[model samples]
Target chain A: MKKFLGAELFFESLYDLGIRTIFGLPGGYVLKIYDVMPSYSKKINHVLTRHEQAATHMADGFSRASGLPGIILCTSGPAATNTITGITTAYSDSVPVLVFTGQVPTPFLGSDAFQEADHIGITRSCTKHNTLVRKTVDLPKAIAEALFISNTGKKGPVLVDMPKDVLISESEYKMPKEVKIKSYSPKVPLKNSEYESFRKVLTASKRPLLIFGKGACSDFNKKLISKFLNKSKLPAMSSIMSLGLIDGTNKFNFGVVGEGGSAVSEDLINKADLIVSVGCDLIKIVPESNLKSKDIVVVNIDKANFNARTKGNMNIHTDSDNFIEKLSAEKGLSFEWEADNLQKLREKYLNSQEKEAKTNKRAGIFKLISNLSPKNSVFCSDFSYEDVILQKFLSVSDFKDSILSGGNGTPGYGFPAAIGATFARPKSKVISISSGINFQFNMQELIVTLEQKIDLTIVVLNEKKNKQKKYSGPDYKSLGESFGVKSHQLSYNDKNFENNFKKFFNHKGTALIEILI
Target chain B: MRHIISILVDNEPGVLARIAGLFTARGFNIESLCVAETEKPSLSRLTLVTSGDEWIIDQIVKRFENMINVIKVEDLSGEDSLERELIIARISTNQKTRSEVLRVADIFRANVVDVGPKSYALELTGNKEKLEAFIEILRPLGLKEISRTGLISLKREKKKITER
Candidate 1:
């Protein structure tokens, strides 16, 4: 007898790759894969979601929290297409995710077959890589490649479009112990010349600034960055995406820099002689216009980011952690204190008082995070005003933690991502920062979070309406209405909102806190 | 500003498309790219020359490393490494031109992979420099067509490195 069945082989491969859970919806097209899922239930738990979008979001969450590739499975057509938004979110944010979609049978393909869509083409732009499995025998390698693509350098989502016939085809399966792709290889180390160039720039600079992004918070670079930041006494400002990377309260911390960022933070970033940006894109720094001055030097991990600035700027391409480590070891660097100017700048922008106000949420959800978060806590948030506010609050604390958010400004991302984050960091407390609108967008995520027994605390900011609209005009109310959130729903009429939220979390292992504003 | 990254990957269809899509979608610049199978079977090496800042490169590398079939990725631009060769064939057969091409090849330690009646297939091995020099000499000698084997390199002996 052949040692492995196709579906069995697929699940085993996923297990070997350390994937413990799959988030998705099941249908006829994926019945075979779903049937074998039970056999691996002990090792892998499957989270059944109401919509395919939620599944992908969960995978996104898991990937962000764990620094491991999150997995999602869904049926064909609308289901597969539904994952596009989530996949795009992962792509833009650089999240590692493996998405498996069931396709119509090969015989039925391109015939307007029931629940059929060209997933390969639709997702081509959003995913880093995607494949359409034609044979059952190819399943193992295809799955492996998807996992690999999703987890590798500049990590992003990879989709595997498995036709129903391929899933059901009987064939002997041989899983490759290793997969080798000729066209792809992740650059691991910095070139010596690049390293030397960075050293020369660092050594020659009087005032240096370090800007860390979400990617710096990964398990691979966290400690390395921490060591470099402390040893160099380099004042650092984190991108909003990288809020909790360093302890926000640390002396060297300057907070997040952007449109809504602290005034001091922006000044520091602008005035730095040498700006060492670790995994952060210039989107935040160069809002309406470019901030590249002749004195600025940017060292980044991805070469694609080198001259992203349209203006004339000095940029070096190297892995952020790699460069930081090299710079820390370099000897003979000294700078004369430009104290008076530095003090003037600091006095002009730094607001220790605003920092306290930002952290005032500490008395509410912010405090809960500090008090309840485990050593390995993973924080995931949706695209909401509250999420940004929470991020600003967390910016001032020193919680060596990971934060996951929608890079594309997509709403309803928090809950599913939180669920995924829980799976990614099972030992840590996973928290979701959401608003009433986001909560409504994917309320089903709460069910999946509970079913998976994922230890999660969802802090839902209960407001009667879209707070962002108050400043924008009449269009805000119309937008809220379009989202099915009525004016009445925006207001907190239920006096026991917290108790209701607590009840939702009770006995489910997951908790929900509805804060009335 | 463009740095060439040589990656050893499984010679599977769609791999190139996937890699290209990644660059294009991210709006990263791919100044030049060359992909072909190597001496190894079922494996091809891709030399992608792209330009980006440190953040973009990190993002690219991180994305590449996560792919399943990609065996290894090396940024040859930053390391002290051995140069890989690219073979190009062009129509040029005059004795003087042939000798001139061979002289340039000999200087760069290149080889004649093929010798047709009207075309000489020259193989040059070196970093972009030697290859460009070889091409420049051939250019005056009826360099009708050109193909490059992007870049393949092995790290000079020193320290063993591990991927983060």
Candidate 2:
């Protein structure tokens, strides 16, 4: 067996796991991983993000878009701290992302060494699984487990914190064929009895409603979902995280249900006789009062948090995709409370909502986005204000195509995720929309786009009144111009603003369009 | 209600601190905590006692299992479990109390660890009720110094313990 630097073995392990890309910023104690990057550069494309936090968003974006584990690397201390929100966001949404952070040497670990951090301590609560490797031989095992645990039963973020000495030390490398944890059994396969129990409720649900949530977005079962929806002919709505589960054009598919949910979606949730929430945590979307209706069924991939989230009549512990697949096979009882009435209500309400959005300057961005978006476009957004527009107006064909911070609700998800989306689908158009303050969260990512020459368009909704005051009175145009991206600023009220907005939207290459409402 | 929850985690460095930090972050205090290596060489069992309402305890237990290092969490509150704490207490000795202290220790089955010039160090391990009873008896003897190992618990093997 040839001797190998632990870092070499670690990167090789990532390559073995089929991670073709890594997003990270280099810092102290993490220099070893960067030093070895050149050796694996051919096999892996490392996108160097400016802030360590954005590295996580980039990885999160990559994972959400590609359905593959996004690998993020950063040094210890502040670098690792930046991963908290991103990792938490991924954890909340159950996105598969593997994070690797450097640590000070073992001797200095507790002595408050320079650039030292208790990465495991900080991220344990936010990650699905995490470990700090003490030995070089364990590096390969740790990396394998990190990826395995991340992409396993309930997909989420995992971290492997490597001490500096462990990376520099020599080790004999042998890639493990399989990684297994005796304690971890992520899958609790559905029993026939359990599935049958849920099936009956779903079938007997007269005036039934279907709710799609984040769990549905992780791995969309397109055939299964559409078949289930069609057979039921139930008026379907999705949580904000699952905006693109069904296209807005689909009759059965109503708009999102959540914080920025439309008035119509709220009405549907309230009036439904039986709510069959598929893979959605009812707490995130349904108002607390409406969570417990006459009948509610919560079907989730992980049933661990369900009992706490709901006093539901039934909880099924099976993969959401599997449950939907099984549901499609069953000849579901016809729920005919009149699909026509709901469809008519949906059309009237959806149209009215759009008309209402068109009347206001701040909310008008939704109408503008809907009008300006061409075919084959995906939008990533951040925070409260912009989330409303992106969740409402952005036309999404697939849930995977729509990216936002659903669970973590962290800001600055837009830009980096757009960068990752560009990489995920190079042929399609990717847009990042956020309010000015939230947009500035990862404004440093401007360098990532410039260096990678990625095709992405960034649109900032500059709320006219800067309530936060931090993002006020700055020329966002100048900031983008400094980064060499085509920067343009226009007011929502400016004459011919619509024409310029469309032109900018249709323009090729990296660009930032700041809209001052 | 006060709940005793035990967590099984990977036996690695800083893991204890991580577990401690989680309590701090959530603004939950660990009333009594005892950690020891389990049967598995790479895993350790941590038993913590804390008091809270049903909802808070439920959330705390859920959060514990969600920790990356945590393998399992068992809230041993209402279960058929055995909880014990070790206490080493020093009693100021006198002609009258010296005999009384040993007589009390004898009844409690506690071992006399050391006999000082003016005090006796007695070691005891028992359930909360038993320990409290013994402490009450020793209170009149005067407590010089006391050290305690916080509660450590295990589910009394249900297969055998309940089968009989």
Best by TM-score: 2
In model 2, the runs with Cα more than 4 Å from the true position are A218-220, A308-312, A466-472, B160-164
Tens digits of lDDT, candidate 1, B1-164 = 66768777878876777678778777887877778777777878787778887667766775676555567777777777665667675757777677777776677777788898777777766667777777777677788787776665556788322232
Among all candidates shown, the one with the greatest lDDT: 2
Deviation in angstroms for A300 in model 2? 2.4
Inter-residue clash pairs, candidate 2: none
Q: Over the stretch A1-517, how does candidate 2's per-residue lDDT look in tens digits?
A: 8999988987888888787888888888878888998988999999988887888998898888878888898999999998898899899889999999999998887788888877877786788878889999988888888888899877899989899999999989977777777667667677789888877776766677778887766444765677666776778888877777776777788777765675677777777777878778776555777766557777876645565645656877677777777776776367666867887888876787777677766567756775677666777888565565446666677777778887677878878888987877788788888878888888989988989998888988777564674447568999899989899998887999888888888877899999987
Candidate 1: residue A76 Cα off by (Å):
1.2
Quantify all predictions' global Cα lDDT against the true fold: 0.68, 0.80
Q: Which window of 10 residues has the lowest lDDT sum in candidate 2 chain B?
A: B155-164
lDDT of each residue in A202-254, candidate 1, tens digit only: 77877887777765665546566666655556677778777767665455666
